[model samples]
Target: MPAGPPGKHNAQAGGLGSVPALGRPERRAESLAVAGLQPFSSVDFPGRLAAVVFLQGCPWRCGYCHNPGLQSRGPGAGPRWPELRDWLARRVGRLDGVVFSGGEPSLDPALPDVLDELRAMGYALGLHTAGLAPRRLAVLLPRLDWVGLDIKAAPTDAALHDRITGRRGSVRAVRESLALLRSGSVDFECRSTVHPAWFTDADVLRLVSELSSVPRHVLQLARLPDASGTARAPIAWPSAALLAEARVIRPDLQLRAA
Candidate 1:
């Protein structure tokens, strides 16, 4: 089911509530504050037909973010998962997988159980994340079938990374998550959203060079900010020439238009 906005549900838990202890009272599934759902998607899960579940909350504030409404853990206008579940129940035969997307799916404590529920329902699990929560992701790794990881910038460039995420230590967390993915059995791809204002053509080349060992990498054009404002001058997007140069280093790189 698709979403409108969050209602009265409390979706964010303050702590990384430890994966529930065995003897504790059976917790009914925590309410997942789903920001939105794309009932069918082929692009999200690679080869499988999948549904996309956009969970709420992201610690980062990348300027080109299209889903700014999902940045806060506060009440949103998104759909509640219980209702989503009933709809999903009827879609079992039509969909082959489910992708947990963000506002950084790793930020929500309820995710592991959510994964378990979907797995039991015979759906393959996929996740899309910015890799801000390495510990959380490490715990969920074994249950996931595929992952789409967003690498914001080169791991060594902390300054640029922080500027993009508007948070400290985010790059370190991303690097650690990358390490975990490389060591695990899960199939995955790394992608980046590029803006000319934040990165030059040389920078893209350098970033791709660092990611040369990754099995797959994609370069996406960042969405330009709203054009209604008069105070800000519009920034030009990275050109096709830039993507061409990047493909030279990572020959298999994919380019996505804004």
Candidate 2:
């Protein structure tokens, strides 16, 4: 999508840039609130065996969020950062990288320092974020090896985008973040979680048309939550016609099943 000039929404209240950076004294490894950790994952970081650190807390509330438990900022019964780091330390040469997946990794103030520490230990770092923190992301970009940016909707569809995220003015922040990634040297991919319940065929086409210029844009089917709240494969898929049209708009568009 065309990267529009920043306007009032870009400066909206509660943007991550408003959060103060952690002072040196408070930049401890444990300062990162850990919701959970995946010891090893081949898929989390493309082309690498890596551990996924699931950080706690997120600003948005997407209905299709798989990590809903991570939405809260309050302390949970998850591993401590020091403990997780010690485990990663032992896998120094065994793993190719470390991925910071999260309710929103950029929301944590300690992230910049944490990235520095992991980078020094010789692990390429990756981040999974929804672009809720454009200013924070700008600071973290120089330290990242790869980033998976989650796009909820076309940048021009602010109402639809905010509705999906259950947050106001999210499109503005995501737009700025997308612009940052486009202008930077970092390798990144744009991904959107799609479900017929949430996105109609026209919605999918609009999103893909806007992302036509992105090097990699993935359309991942959104998993449904069973009665027990476990994520299961989607019962339905986007129409074949829609997928065909999407590819015509962005030939490089990738469709992934849940």
Q: Estimate each model's TM-score.
A: 0.84, 0.86
Candidate 2 residue pairs in clash (backbone atoms < 3 Å)? none
Leading candidate by TM-score: 2
Q: 215, model 1: CA deviation in Å?
A: 1.3
Clashes of 1: 5
For model 2, residues 188-230, the per-residue Cα lDDT tens digits are 9999888877887889899999998887999888777689987
What is the TM-score (0 to 1) of candidate 2? 0.86
Cα lDDT tens digits, model 1, 1-258, are: 112232222243112133332232114444665776676778878899998888888879987676667888853345555556655666788999999886878877778887887787798999999888899999899889999999888878888889988888779999999999998899999988777778877778888999899879887776564566422322554556776787778889887752
Q: Deviation in angstroms for 53 in model 1? A: 0.7
Misplaced by over 4 Å in model 1 are 1-28, 226-237
Runs of candidate 2 exceeding 4 Å displacement: 1-27, 226-233
Q: List the residue pairs that clash in candidate 1.
A: 5-77, 5-78, 6-76, 6-77, 6-78
